[model samples]
Target: MTAVSLVDVASHLPPERVGREYFERYSRPDDPLLRNPMFRAPEYRRYAAREDTGADLVERAAAVLFERHGSDLAGEIDLLVTHNALPDVPFLGSGAEIARRLGCRPAQIVDLHNGHCAVFPYMLGLARSLMRDTGARTALLCTAQTAGRIFTQPGVRRSAHAAVPGDGAAVGLLRASGESPILATEVRHYPDHAPDVALKLDDGRLYWEPGTSEFDVAFDNSKAYNIIERGSEIVPEVVTRVCERIGATPKDIDLLVTNQPNRLLLRNWGAALGIEAPRHFDTFDSYGNLFGAGVPVNLDHALRAGRPAGGGLVVMAGFAGAGELAAAAAVRLPGPDRPATPTTGGPR
Candidate 1:
């Protein structure tokens, strides 16, 4: 079978509504009562105001993707894939809505709601399969996250989820190709940690409960710890596997697009892996953690900032709701001669 490669990728954030200044002012000041500092960072607009919901982020991101590709809703898009945890509204799934807005037919849509690490790899696998079965020439893969809706709470002092979660969304276009720049992909799952990260139903509402005390006592105690504890191990392992399969290493990669859970986590993970942190592109400093959207959004930033030079590789990894871990690598295709412009505009 021919290896699959991502042909085009792009990302989007609501707008530059939140920034460092906002964080410094709002986040708790030395709240020693909780595991981590109380969400001191200024609350993101999506979380703070609730003006634009997760669905809104997805729509805006889809608009950005379409614009970047220089394609219209009427274009020849064969498949649409979206990775997300919190759908726009509780009742209707965001994937269907996104496809509708893009004018995609029902049969052409696929929704993967597997949380963090599983998203990228799952999407790659689905895209690969679609290419083989249907010979889909154009597939729109989008990951949209709205951390604000998930983490923030009323009168809750500090939350592990709050410390890192951010809001954002990203989209990518993939097509079957036999090319060097767009390389192969591999995926794996560690079922042992399945109970570590997850969302639980409480009074009919979904809440991110990173493994509770009872869960810790029952399962591997340490597994319930914050994502950082195992993140270092999981990320490098996946990266090594993907790189080894492709005959490349961290040094050869021009960009490392991982989940932007936290600045410190990214720094520590990069150092531990001996991979110079690829130009860290982040919306988390302002947006918070957009659960599934991290990788794709960052990839879009790297592309817009100026495509990395020859043989540039992008390593994307994430861990979300279900103690899930996902990682994939894509080489940058020769960029378009003309940079694409943003057709949709909003708060930024």
Candidate 2:
């Protein structure tokens, strides 16, 4: 029996509105990427409001979930796991602070720093395993992407890739119940690509060391090509493996959601798996690249819009940080037209 299922998802996007004009001011029409069909200027209008200027994005998102579900849901969480690509506090994740602010005293707390964009499934896998092993009923998983804080800098903003990232947070509520049950999941890590995604600075100072040189993505042409190919391949690979685990195929999934890096990867993954555009969910045109929060945010978007209908099979799949980690899962979505209140579940 499945131990945990994603009962619901809620997202918090900042109030600020930025547009393609924001990036166009720095980049020119002659930019090679502008002409690439695969490339699209990030038109995400929201910013998480420079690091720490307001309530944490994760907190805001979770508050929405609790408000919609009930305050009691906050008290029921047994485990809380958080993944933020850019942590406001150095040497400390925002998990403890978030839990504190939300009035949740979880039995366990995890502040994961890696797993990147694909960490959504990784967290889901971790939640189910822990819930089963510890005899717990509920878990809260939170992911935030604040890449805009760094990308908006004068030094880095000139590059086109700088505009690819946006800011927001999405938190999912998982319970040990059949409501929105998770069917099967697969997670993989490749050490060869672990070092491929990195930060570059011309001054040769380590990221931790004090330096005046601004940082940017270190990807070169060879690394970029290899990463793109691996990304185009690995995501579908995991999705297929997951579907096959449950005696189905990607064709059986009613809706597909993945990290919204850009149009290139999105189109490639669907084409590779034969999933059509209508059945696939995308937020790139409005939300840009949301990093780890991308998938959950999209899931929340779909649910709020009353999409994929009820009793549908949905698949969430993507790779994280270059191509080092990938994960996918098959889920039986909740019924009756939209996300519903969760039923507390535990050991059978």
Candidate 3:
């Protein structure tokens, strides 16, 4: 039997760190958003240069993973999946370009558009199922969030949302080997909430309309409340459900990684799960919100800081938009020997 196992994770955060005050030129010190808990900015967050597109960040991150794993990994990938928050071009994904640049010709590629901020688990689950059915030996999954580009626009630079996110990309290598077997993956979608999130302009002009000014994300007070309420509820629920599938409780999770949009949500999630402060980790302060990329980037940061990703269990989870989608994935870290034990999920 073949089981998909996580090889390792790598991330590339643009080196330029911007402080909250950077938004002052566009906004104001007395701005109500400054005092709002959700909009309260972190001390500093990384940003990609204006010229840097989402594909650029993904390439750099994937390059780091390839360098660490050696050049041979480039040729071994038979499947590639990419989910970029701000793709370079409209109406197309960056999968083909990424695969081509990385020398993964003849690779089957997927450009996922729906999963949004908490898309990592969706990527993982899809990769596992595809590799299993196709008998593919290796797969590369990538996610990039270009907040630097989106927030810097004339339409949004002054808004509090501009200060709440960072720019970065992350990549994870999964192979048919079970050195660190994936225990389970689960996902749920809520189409009703999808419309709750949309673009906002100064006037009624549509995004593509000629008269449309720079647009920012906008929702009414009630919808905004629902988004927060739903996220707070669904994130922990999915994580707990994932734990149950593997015959473990939240206490068994040695490490928990999740999308870090704000400090409140991060705190609430751990408390609800009964997970200790030390057991759960987030990069909200350092990198801010990296969208769906947060899961892999945070995981990489934790592992590099010597957090134990091995010798125990780890779970990653998050919800996209208000609750348009939610997903969670669990993995059993290998012991010192890193055995090749199989999971029943592989191509049956």
| lDDT, candidate 2, at 51 | 48
What lDDT tens digits, residue by residue, belong to model 1 across residues 5-88? 576665666554544443333445554422333223434533423676555666676676566556564366678887665566
* TM-score for each of the candidates: 0.77, 0.93, 0.93
In the range 182-295, model 2's lDDT, one tens digit per residue, is 888899988888888888988999988998999777755566678788999999999999999999988988899899888889999999999999889988889888889899
Residue 293, candidate 1: Cα error in Å is: 0.5
- The worst-scoring run of ten residues by lDDT in candidate 2 lies at 339-348
Where in model 1 is the C-alpha error above 4 Å? Answer: 1-4, 19-51, 70-73, 157-163, 178-182, 198-226, 278-283, 335-348
RMSD of each: 6.0, 3.1, 3.7
Model 2 spans with C-alpha error above 4 angstroms: 28-39, 51-55, 337-348
Positional deviation of 41 in candidate 1, in angstroms?
A: 5.4
lDDT of each: 0.58, 0.81, 0.82
